[model samples]
Target: MTEHTSIRIRVTGHVQGVGFRAWTQARAEELGLWGWVRNVADGSVEAWVSGPAGAVADLVEALGHGPAAARVAAVETGPADAASDAAGAGFRILR
Candidate 1:
């Protein structure tokens, strides 16, 4: 069985008010990932993503460019303290 991993990602630049959260939700669900995406107070987009290692990596890579409306400046990733099931059943968009 594939090993599962969890990571926290913070995407900077032009990420707010650009459907970045909704776009991330779609991608995470498509990848069968469990996590939450939200717009940060600092004007960045943050996510706690958990899933198969490969899927997590793919999602991180995709976050680099983000939605067509987003102009991603940078993406920072690190180990997430939360468990894979922390987000529960599926991906979500947190307000």
Candidate 2:
């Protein structure tokens, strides 16, 4: 079986008010991942993603260039706790 991994990603630059969270949720779900994406007070997008290692890596890569409206400048990732809980079975957009 494939090993599961978890990561916390922070995407900077032109990520707010441009459907970044929604886009992230869709992408994560499409990759069969479990996580939550939210807007940060610092004008960046934050997400806690957990799933198959490959899928999680794919999601992180995609975050580098979000929705068409987004102009992503940087994407920072770090290890996340495995017990982090998502809102539902699939990916979710957190307020």
Candidate 3:
């Protein structure tokens, strides 16, 4: 079954202030994902990605590379938080 699912990914390394969030937003939209990406105080980029299984997987793969300007060190993907609705609206950048 191709049901919707949410994946929360925490990207480590030099991922802040280097257009990571914008890149993630663009990639997520390209994959037709529905979620958001934000910068955490812990110096990591966090993303809430939700969509089809394939799309979510693709998003994770993209995060592994990020923008050409980004030097992605690591990307951790797993189930989203219980508070996050798997049936959210669309992909975006959180404040």
RMSD of each: 1.5, 1.7, 1.4
lDDT per residue as tens, model 2, 1-95: 98888889999999999999989999999999988999999999999998899999999899998999999999999988767855347787889
Candidate 2 lDDT score at position 70: 99
TM-score of 1: 0.94
Which parts of model 1 are misplaced by more than 4 Å? Answer: none
For 1-95, candidate 1 gives per-residue lDDT tens digits of 98889999999999999999999999999999988999989999999999999999999999999999999999999989754457447898888
List candidate 3 segments past 4 Å from native: 86-88
User: Residue by residue across 1-95, what tens digits does model 3's lDDT show?
Assistant: 88777879999988888899998988888888888889999999998888888889888988998887788899998888968765657778888
- Candidate order by TM-score, highest to lowest? 1, 2, 3
Worst 10 residues of 1 by lDDT: 81-90
Worst 10 residues of 2 by lDDT: 81-90
**TM-score of each model, in listed order:** 0.94, 0.93, 0.90
* Candidate number that wins on lDDT, 1 or 2: 1
lDDT (Cα) of model 2: 0.90
